[model samples]
Target: MGMSVGPSGGGGGRRRGGSRAPMAEINVTPFVDVMLVLLIIFMVTAPLLVAGVPIDLPDSRANALEQEKEPVQISLDAEGQAFIDDAQVSMDDLPAQLEALRKQRGEDNGDAPQVMLRADRSLDYGKVMLVMGELNRAGLNRVSLVTTGSSDRP
Candidate 1:
């Protein structure tokens, strides 16, 4: 009888040389799963990112303006109550408050700070015009009216 000796014991022991090397390839299944979960979370929350006072905007067929800076938002509810950046303020205090805000914004380029007016769809035209006049008087000449886009029907 001949006896053979090797690195592994030859007495009914399992061979180890045929074993596979530790897997060097990255497992992307968990990574892909985490990415998909993050994508779903962002998709679910994207619409809720636009924060502002809720009011029904009038429909218009106007081109949207290109925004350069954050404009001061002024909202008027259906009851004619005024709000500046979601904070309620009396009509009498609006101009001074707006002027202070403009000064704080450092409007020194000969261009007035832009103000976005968001009035309820049911608000009276006169009330809107009056607010416009107030904004103009506050030295905020670059006033833009915010409205929802609508398609014209024949």
Candidate 2:
């Protein structure tokens, strides 16, 4: 309740004039919770800020790729379905489709487009290599494998 300019105690007590107000003491658990949630969101999305589309990369002992721009990532899911960027591309149509994408990417003027393959750990190497061959044939020689960082616990 706000105090009015009057005797508050209902007696002969006078109100203090322009005295400094008492500091408020309040619980801070909600503030801490909100801060923690923001921290979690930042951590979860930080890695995704990197180049290219997001993919669940397979773990490997090989060294990581160091580049400024994200490559055109290709994913081979558990069922061996092929995805260029985020869109599914049939195996038979991959070379022609990639050629079209390369042209659209201004490879005729700008730097050549690239391909990066992310295969399921259980997937056969032959299929991945076959896709590599197709990418090579399509003149996308910058093809490489995507993998989780060695320091990553997952």
Candidate 3:
């Protein structure tokens, strides 16, 4: 007598018969991780990109002013030395440089460019006034004093 062992089909129907197809679903976990790292790097380096002369500014409770254009930056360090946007300029040459800048910006059309004055807190009042005097002589009358915001505020 012949004895039957069992069903002997290919793969025994336990697995798919054909080769597996390529995976249609994409893995986004790695892509998201890379993007997050790039964002963090930019956040850390953004503030350092602002290049300017450093000086100790006094804190004020006054609100910031609205600006229509990029203002000129004039800084005075603790030694009473003046700088025009990070360039060390002698007090005697301040007017000529300012005048040249004013003319180059075409301020004669009546739209005066604003000037922001930054003076160290330790500087004497007279020194600050002297810079202001130079600004006025250069016909830059619309001036604003730059001060840091008070840290005690909520």
lDDT of 2 by residue, 1-154 (tens): 7445555544434546644566698879999999999999999999987645444666667786677665787888767788888888898888898788767764555656767778877778888888888877777777788788674554
Query: Can you write out model 3's per-residue Cα lDDT over 34-126, one digit (the tens) per residue?
Result: 999999999999998763787899988888999877888899999998988889999888889989867776456765579899999999999
TM-score sort, best first: 1, 3, 2
Candidate 3 Cα lDDT to native: 0.84
Candidate 1 lDDT, tens digit per residue, 30-133? 99999999999999999987636778898888889999888888999998989998799899898888888778874577677788999999999999998999
lDDT at position 72, candidate 2:
81
Query: After superposition, which runs of candidate 1 have C-alpha atoms over 4 Å from their true positions?
Result: 1-24
By the lDDT metric, which is better: model 2 or model 3? 3
Scored against the true structure, residue 43 in model 3 reaches a CA lDDT of 100
Clashing pairs for model 3 are none
lDDT of 3 at 108: 62
Q: Candidate 1 local accuracy as lDDT?
A: 0.84
**Relative to the unseen true structure, what is the C-alpha lDDT of residue 81 in candidate 2, on a scale of 0 to 100?**
80
lDDT, model 1, position 28: 98
**lDDT of prediction 2:** 0.75
- TM-score of each prediction: 0.77, 0.60, 0.74
RMSD in Å for all candidates? 5.8, 8.1, 8.1
